[model samples]
Target: MPRMRSSSVIPHLLREQANAVQLYLQYKGYHWNVAGPLFRELHLLFDEHATTVFETIDALAERQRMLGAAAAYTLEDIRLASTIPHERGLPRTTQEMLERLIAAHHVIIEGMHEGFKSAESDQDPGSADLFARFVQAHEKMEWFLRELASEPPPTSEVTGRSSLAREKGVPAAAIPSSHAAPPFAGPPLT
Candidate 1:
C-alpha cells in the first residue's frame, strides 16, 4: 500500500469534519423545531440524520487524528471553515426544512467527492473508502428528503390521479375523508 501524504489530505479531512459538525447541529435544530402536518415524520427523520452525521463527525475527527492533524474542537472552528452555513432561524414549514437539509447534503456530497479524489490520488485507500461511505449515506438521506418534498401541491392541476385507493379498486372519492390515526387511542386529554 502506498503511504498517505498528510499534507495533501489533512485540509480535506478538516473541511469534511467541519461540514459534519455543521450538519449534525443543523439536524438537531430541525429535529427540535419541526412542526405541522408532517411533524412526526420530519422530526424522526431529523433525529436519525443527526445521529448519522454525529457518527460521521467522529469518524472524520478520528481520521484527522490518525493523519497526525488536529481536528476541529469547537463550533467556532467548524463555522469558520465549513462551507454549509448555520441556519438563521427555524424554517417556516416542514418543506422549507427538508429543502434546507437537501441543500446542506448537496454541499457535503460535493465535498466528499472532492476529498475522495484527493485521497485516491494521494494513495490513501482508507481515507477514500471513508469518503465514499459518507457520500453514499448523504446521498440516501438527500434522496429521502427530496422525495418527501417532491409531492405536488394540493391545489395543483393533477390529472389521471393514482393513489392507494385507486389501486384497491376503489374510486378516490370513495376513500374515507379522514384516516384520523385510529382515533389516537393512547390516552385521554386531561
Candidate 2:
C-alpha cells in the first residue's frame, strides 16, 4: 500500500489530470478554429501541445492507479474538479485564442506549483516529482504562447490569405509571397 501522504496527494493529482484534459481539448479546438495570418504556425503548435497534454493525462491517471487509488476521470468528474473555464464558443481571433490559452496555462501552472508544494509537504517524493514535471511543461507552453503574443503581427504578405489555405491542406508558409504563389502541397484539405 502507498504511504498515507502519498494517498493525500491523489486528489490533487486527480484534479490536475482533469485540468490537463480540459487543456487538451481546448488546445485542439483552437487548432481547428484558429484563423488569421499565423494560422499554420499556431495550428501546428497547438496540435503538438495538445498531443503532449493527452499523454500527460494518460500518465497521470495511470499514476493514480499505480498508487492504488481510484482515479476521478469521467467527464462529469473533470467538469467538477477542473478550474479551467468552460468554452461556449471559439475565440473571435487568433490573438484571443492565444490569450485564452495563456490564461488557462496560468491557472494550470499555478495549480501545479501548489500541488508540488503539497506533495512535498506530504512527504511524497514521487508525487512531488510528477507535479514538478507538469509545472515545467506548463511553463514551457506558457512561454511559447506569451512569445507568440509578443510577436509582430503576421506581415501583410499573409494578411489577404484565407485561413482555409492553411486548414485545407496547403502549407501556410507555402501560401506564397506577393512576388509569387506556390502550388498548394499536402493531403487534400478536408
* Best model per lDDT: 2
Please provide, for model 2 over 2-31, each residue's C-alpha lDDT reduced to its tens digit, 9 standing for 90 to 100. 554246677778888999999999999999
Q: How many clashes in candidate 2?
A: 1
Backbone clashes in candidate 1 total 0
TM-score of 1: 0.78
Off by over 4 Å in 2: 4-6, 151-190
The deviation in Å at residue 75 for candidate 1 is 2.0
Can you tell me which runs of candidate 1 are displaced by over 4 Å? 1-6, 153-190
Give the best candidate by TM-score.
1
> Per-model C-alpha lDDT, please?
0.77, 0.78
lDDT of 1 by residue, 1-190 (tens): 3334345878888898998888898999989987655567778989998999899888888887777777788868888889976789877666677778899999989999999999889878888999999999999999988877664334312222224333433223323435212333557779
